[model samples]
Target chain A: MSWITDEMRGIVGKVMREAVSHPIALSDIRKWAMAVYWPEPLPRQYWDEDYAAQFGGIVAPEDFNPFAWMAAKPTPDDPPVSMSAFRESELGVETPDYKAILLTEIRARHGAPMRPGDVIRCVWKISDYMEREGRMGLMLYTTLS
Target chain B: MGDPRTLAVGDEIPAFSREGTVHHWNRFAAVNYEFAGHHWDDDVARHEGFPAPFAMAPLLHAYLHAMLRQWAGPSARIAAVGIRLRSPFLKGCSMTAGGRITAVRTKAGETVAELELWMDDDTGARLSTGTATVAFPS
Candidate 1:
């Protein structure tokens, strides 16, 4: 039996196409942290440059915008049935553009990862969007489901 | 005392590691929605020619994040982190979580630090590698 189901696939497709945004907050970050199988007591150092470079940089929370982030990208013509498609298509929705609707509860674990037959529901809401001014510019606050 | 806060590049961070068993795989499978019948079902995974049920890449990212967060402290915010899955983490296999500081800089008046990270098998085979950036309280 597969873990990813048709209905869930449709839901993922629908979520990807929607023009929505949420504000990023420190608390929201914690919630995401708690949702995962985190080890007790974190390390005492940051991830080196090679790892850090993957994130690129933080998107200004105040300047956060998704439409501009997607910018003329084509929506998935079909529901993604494979992880590669999901990453190449939907995940790219935030690629390059750091601004994204942060999904706090989405956690992956060691296993066959989701299979084709699994069906599940994901509930998310707009968390916060704070405005901050810094020497660089205005920071936008936005998080997503 | 000398600066307890000054961390030079190349300083090693406290590392932690763990191994996943079929139980861990099963637990992960229950929550994940992308498994295609091969995970936790040896018949399925074997029939599909998979050595064993493999861990999800994003989950690997989560584990790495957990390692960094534990180091940064409770109040620290994760500004950004990224990881690339290089090898598979099979059921009943162990992997180590470790990182080292590579650079430190200032941006927007905040001290930003960078780290190099790796998750390896018991033999020290690299499964995933990447970096994390965080801002600590000044």
Candidate 2:
């Protein structure tokens, strides 16, 4: 039997959650660059506005993630749910008891670069799923976008 | 850095290396809001069947981006990046990420390059494989 139930598969292509971020701060971008490139001098474009004057005054890295700790749209009071699980109960189905979840893959597409004071929004959905046989057992890979 | 004009299929980009440590992971966790015990606690990792706490997946993804931006330069656009994790990047291991150009072409008047990407630790374990597309201005 497949690990994904019919109902679980039904939820695919449905929006799981949405969030709007607080304005992106230059500090947020700088700190992120510092953390990711620890011990290495960061590229001048990230922290040195003088050097980045050509990029229209310091654009955030293409991979920079804006929504980290919190979001403006989903305030702290919002019902907290494991986005990975997305509460199978919501589908009126039994939540599968799983040992773990691994972020097996990541795909990011960049548009115009984000800058200081830019507010970003994200909508997540269960894009697809498949099963694979691995060292431990049959693992289910779920795609979220 | 190779000139974007001279870039061609089969060109290997510079690699980015980092020692897998909680000091780095902790900072990334702080910024990304990733606080899973399996990432910072060896006991938790062992409980989860890993020899030591491992690096976060998103960090590995970001490392690839860092490598790309370094090669393509600031003005270049990182059109898209996709990665597949094969093994965990365990703590104390140093991993290096590198990319090789698979295709180079002109799209919409911009120079576009597609690359195959990979990351391996000091132990030679391949942690992840990926693909990326970068577009440079005409």
Estimated TM-score per prediction? 0.52, 0.93
* Each model's iRMS: 13.9, 1.5
Which residue pairs in model 2 clash with each other?
A: none
For model 2, how does the per-residue alpha-carbon lDDT over A19-74 read when each residue is reduced to its tens digit? 88899999999999988888787788998989899867888877777878877867
DockQ of each: 0.05, 0.74
TM-score of chain A of 1: 0.23
Runs in model 2 lying further than 4 Å from the true structure: A82-94
Off by over 4 Å in 1: A1-16, A19-35, A38-145, B1-4, B29-34
How far off is model 1, as Cα RMSD? 16.0
- Candidate 2, backbone clash total: 0
Output the lDDT of residue A84, model 2: 27
**Candidate 1 residue lDDT tens string, B39-117:** 4566765654557776655456667766765666533445666676656677778888888889877666556677888
